[model samples]
Target: MKPLALPSGSRWSAAHLCGLSVVLVPTCFLAVLFIWPVLRLLALGFGDEAGPFHSYLRVFTVPAYREAILTTFEIAIAVTVLSVMLAYPVAYLMATVSPRMARLIGIGVLLPFWTSALVRTTAWIMLLERYGILNSVLMRAHLIRHPVAFVYNMSGVLIGMSHVLMPFVVFPLYTAFRGLDRNLVQAAMLLGAGPLTLCRKIFIPLTAPGALAGANIVFMSALGYYITPALMGGPAQTMVSQLISFNVSEQLDWGMAGALSGVMLVLTLAAFFLCRGVLEKRLKRRVVTAARPYGEGLSGRSGAGWGMVIAGCAVMVFLLAPIVIVFPMSVSASPILMFPPHGLSFRWYHELLSRPQWAGAFFNSLKVALIAVPVATVLGTLAAIGLARMKGTFAQILEGLFILPMVVPAIILAVGLYYQLTPLGLTRGYWGLGLGQAVIAMPFVFLTVQATLRGFSRDLELAAMSLGAGWFSVMGRIVLPALMPAIVSGAIFAFITSFDDVILALFLTDVRARTLSRLIYENVLQDVSPTITAVAVLVIVLTLGLLLSSLLFQREKS
Candidate 1:
């Protein structure tokens, strides 16, 4: 069949219009819904005619606020370092394994991510409580005289955070490792390089960008974390998020909250730019080295070094321990969390079911996420397709704008939504919460779908059009099938993001619209219950199942 050729100028103009529309819609949406609200909130920090800038100045001058900032950074850095160290080996294993094994391992790493952060944080609380499993086991074996203070402190906060953040590090590193040229490693070995030398000179350098990207993500996220630290850490260990929440809700001090949020926003942007600069440098270096022949002859020791292998396995286990400890504690018959339960029972699970509030909250969360996921996914995919096919500066700017949700702090978004939605008669309802979640979820969907579109050739779409199909027909028949995997992946991410969200839900929810994460937050703060542990376990199971299903589907397609 002959192609339908359009004049070059007309084609370019059409592309420009398409791009402009793509960029304009999202840019307008974000400007109204996200950007304006945040700017308005930040304006509160400067004070109105009623008062001076004393509140902002006071917060900055206070030692307590300074300590909070320092503590937040300290914990974020620690979590980033720990998450990377643990994620590297798992990523390597995933990279080197058979396809089937890699898929299974990938599913395993993603499992924790499906569970809500609040649920995961409470699980850590149960496991690290004074009479929790760790202490119970140690005491039973006569290893200690009294229960250790693991929970309600910095140690517990770090352990819980690292567990939750590990998957972020693993996924990026896994992707990077999978994309590595195996020939390069073999070439290094052939050049007589030792194992350590190969790792230092070749593997490490190659994977550094992924490592940096993952670490930056973890660090940025950890900085704004509220639930985990609030649940696991005591008053002394409070992070900046908690402080911001306290100012807004407890003290009714909007000025300080706004200032703190602005500070966090600035810091986050700085970290992102710093990471971008480092990545650009690494990419330039890689480009320079592209023409070099693969180095060979890395030193071999006893066929893959069992000692290093064992150490790596041990680290994996350590990373996974917090999650592993939750099962026994939930199933324990004893009211208090204990290890090797005197007798196992389903009491906690039954408790979770019988409790009306917990069960109701679960259903509420499910309903909201189910509704938000599909809506966000479709919108995001449409935007991605339009941007990909269109050629204009407007399209590029819009694509970037669509992903701004990733950079903005959820707490700030929550505060903004709380203020804006109230006037629209949307606050404290399911619709309000769902809307807020969709705003955040859309960005993930956009990224996933856009990446998927980038991988596909536009020739199929052109061919379909040449066959006399209309625009809709070409998209549905040709582009849709090719982009199905990405759509599904993006939908899954949207679902999980909504399911795991706490900050937005916390602000926008009243009793009737409370989400599971919000419910878990209340339970942890009000009364840490075994019922919460049961809920946490159920969340973990559901998430794992969803992740496994996604992997299986992807594997079958492959």
Candidate 2:
């Protein structure tokens, strides 16, 4: 669609006023609920009368806080490196195989991506438990005489985080490979290069930019991890985010929390720009120049071709293991959350069905998503329309303002909203949590709608307007129908993003406003029961259905 035409002349004129009207709801929504709240939290860091930097000194000097800072970066680096390693071959296979095979393995890779990180973390705990399937297999085969301790440790944290983050790495690499030229591999082979030699000297170097980009994504995302570490890790594994939460909720130290949050925000912003800066632009151009159709030059040798495919399959299985393992575990007759059930049955699932708390969580999640998604979709669509027609610094600034929720970590938002909302008596109810979720979910809708609108035309709208159709009629009859698919896509994603959230809910949810993720977190920490397995299975299946629906929608669009 063509960009919407900007109103001309004075800012107070009717046309300009109308355009500004489109910006009011979202801008004010983000301002009062999102931006002002964050600004308030940042200001609170200096509430200490000792000095402006007093809270900073405390965070840096305190051993507990110091350790969280160090642990955050350490885990982020490890997660990024491993994600790159595991994801590369699968991405390569996706780019090289037939479309059907690509789609099959791609779903395997995406199963964990679409599922909640909370669910995946829960699944990992079960998978690595002493009586879990992994240990049972090893024990029966004599690989080990006893089950190993895997849950509640750094090992479990890594496994859970890696499963969650691998998809972030895969997507950029897959996009990069889709644009890669195959002739480089063929040329290298024709020049008498062996498989390893060609891979190292030609393919690896060409895709190095993609790897770097993917690593940046993994690192930044992992830096803000809360649920995985909280559930799967020990005391020593606490990250900077958990430290912030602890300072606020347990210790009642908002100043220190704000200071620590400030440090994180600065670092996150710096890294965001660094990752998206000039180097990324150059890399994008290279990827595009390198782009070619799949399967042209992927098969150079019997050993190398089959070996890479096998590696990819293994990696894909690793990605899907946590999601797939939960199904049978859910039905296991053992009420103690063990594997190799005393017998096969649906005992846990039946128990889950019997719980009112579980039902409340389910309803609460739907309630939040239902309230948030539509508001986000409409305002985001309006923002997209306004942003489409604006120009220069004004447009860039507005666009970035809307995207701040996505760029800043959820921990910061949680802290900000708590400090700001509590003062106004807005923190205790569903409205508070719903508004926060809508702000976070808003950017998702805006970006997706904008993406589709980039290729869309408003010529039909112009034609209808000229033919004397009113604004509503044009919107109702022509423009909305054209953009409805994009709206639906964005709303679905926004709903999932809101529904799968744990960090924001942790800070904002009250007794009556509890969500599914909160319930899962509570169960993991206190109950350690088999009902979590049933919950995980249900969540995984719902996510799978969403993924398939998205795929079918895309297929239809294409």
For each candidate, the alpha-carbon lDDT, in order, equals 0.78, 0.81
lDDT of 2 by residue, 1-558 (tens): 985555565445444455567777899999988888888888888888899889999888989888888988888888988899898888888887878888887778767787888888777777787777788889989999888988778888888888888887887788767766766656776889997897788667766777877777788778888888888889889998988888899989888888988888887888778877855676656634454444555555467777877898898878878787778777887767666667899877888889899999999988878878888888898888677766557668889898888878898998888887777776666777788889889997899878977897878777888999997897788867777777777887888888898878887878777999888887788756888888888887787787678767866865
Per-residue alpha-carbon lDDT of model 1 for 1-558, expressed as tens digits? 985556777856655565566556656666777888889888888884556676667666899898899899999999999899888878876666567777776756666666677766766676678877677778889999999999788899888889888888887787667656657766777999887997799777778888998998898888888778877888788888888888888998888888888888888888977997888788777643333222122234334455444655675666556566678777888887666665888999998888898879988998898768876887788788878867656565676678778877788889878877888878666887887788899898889889888789878777887888987797778888888877887888888888888888888888888988888878778987777778877877777777667667766766
Query: What is the RMSD, in Å, between candidate 2 and the native fold over all Cα?
Result: 3.4
Task: Give the Cα error of residue 535 in candidate 2, in Å.
Answer: 1.6
Q: Which ranges of candidate 1 are over 4 A from the true structure?
A: 1-12, 22-24, 48-56, 175-196, 288-304, 391-393, 555-558
Report the error of model 2 at residue 107, Å: 2.7
- Choose the strongest candidate by lDDT: 2
Pick out the ten consecutive residues of candidate 2 with the lowest summed lDDT.
10-19
Candidates in order: C-alpha RMSD to true structure: 3.6, 3.4
